[model samples]
Target: DAGVTQSPTHLIKTRGQQVTLRCSPKSGHDTVSWYQQALGQGPQFIFQYYEEEERQRGNFPDRFSGHQFPNYSSELNVNALLLGDSALYLCASSVTGGELFFGEGSRLTVL
Candidate 1:
């Protein structure tokens, strides 16, 4: 079975720009979570989606948002990007509250 997958492996954006990253969850998975990993720091949860509904969110600002589709694929969107927003955006999938399987991650660089 295929693992999680993310598109646009790398991206470059300017401050105030918006970007969207996409992901396809692992087979048989139904929950998707998004994370941001700044250089030298561990992943920080952004939000989680299940059953096409957002279930939990972290300390991130409203500029961070996500969507999960019926097929369990997901998208992460960041608006008004800032230089500090540059990081490895990760997508993880699993059954609700279960162990997570992570994607290769989408790297975003804001200038």
Candidate 2:
């Protein structure tokens, strides 16, 4: 009965570096969505994965990408990371169009 889970809890990277964050969705969930939350701001949708395909994406640049596994788990990868890319990356799982359960989030800091 585990809820959503995110790995690496924290990270530090330099500009232009690439980073990958992982997530395990809650049981019985089939949709995984990635969000970025900067300090003092609300979460911004990065993209969503369903059936191993990207079903929807936000206003983020092309550098942000994601994948969904058979078990409904997911990964978020950011290429050529920038200072402004540093934020709390959240993984939210839900039965498509239903209520979502969010993970603790992986914090990234770019220097």
Candidate 3:
């Protein structure tokens, strides 16, 4: 079975540029969650989508937004990105509230 996948293993951008990252959830999974992991820190939840609707959201600003498709694939969008927004964008898929399976993530670098 296929596992979760993410594109653009690394990227570089300047301040105020928007970026979009893609993810495909693991096979047989229905929920997809997005996380932001800064250097040397654990991943922080940004939002989760199930059945194409947002189910849970974390303490992220409005600039952080996401969408999930019927196939359990997801995309994260950040507008007016800042230096602070530079981090590893991780995508995790889970069936319940316990552990989550994550993708390698797309590392965003703001210069």
TM-score of each: 0.98, 0.98, 0.95
- For each candidate, what is the lDDT? 0.95, 0.96, 0.92
lDDT of 2 by residue, 2-83 (tens): 9999999999999999999999999999999999999999999999999999999999999998889998899999999999
Better of 2 and 3 by TM-score: 2
TM-score of 3: 0.95
Per-residue lDDT value at 33 in model 3: 94
Please provide, for model 3 over 29-59, each residue's C-alpha lDDT reduced to its tens digit, 9 standing for 90 to 100: 8889999999999999899999999999999
Q: Tell me how far the alpha carbon of residue 22 in candidate 3 is from the true structure, in angstroms, after superposition.
A: 0.5
Please identify model 1 stretches exceeding 4 Å from their true place. none
Of 2 and 3, the candidate ranking higher by lDDT: 2
Cα error of candidate 2 at position 16, Å:
0.7
By TM-score, the better pick of 1 and 3 is: 1
Query: Which 10 residues in a row give candidate 2 its minimum summed lDDT?
Result: 64-73
Candidate 2 TM-score, true structure as reference: 0.98
Q: Please give the lDDT score at residue 72 for candidate 1.
A: 89
Which runs of model 2 end up more than 4 angstroms from their true locations? none
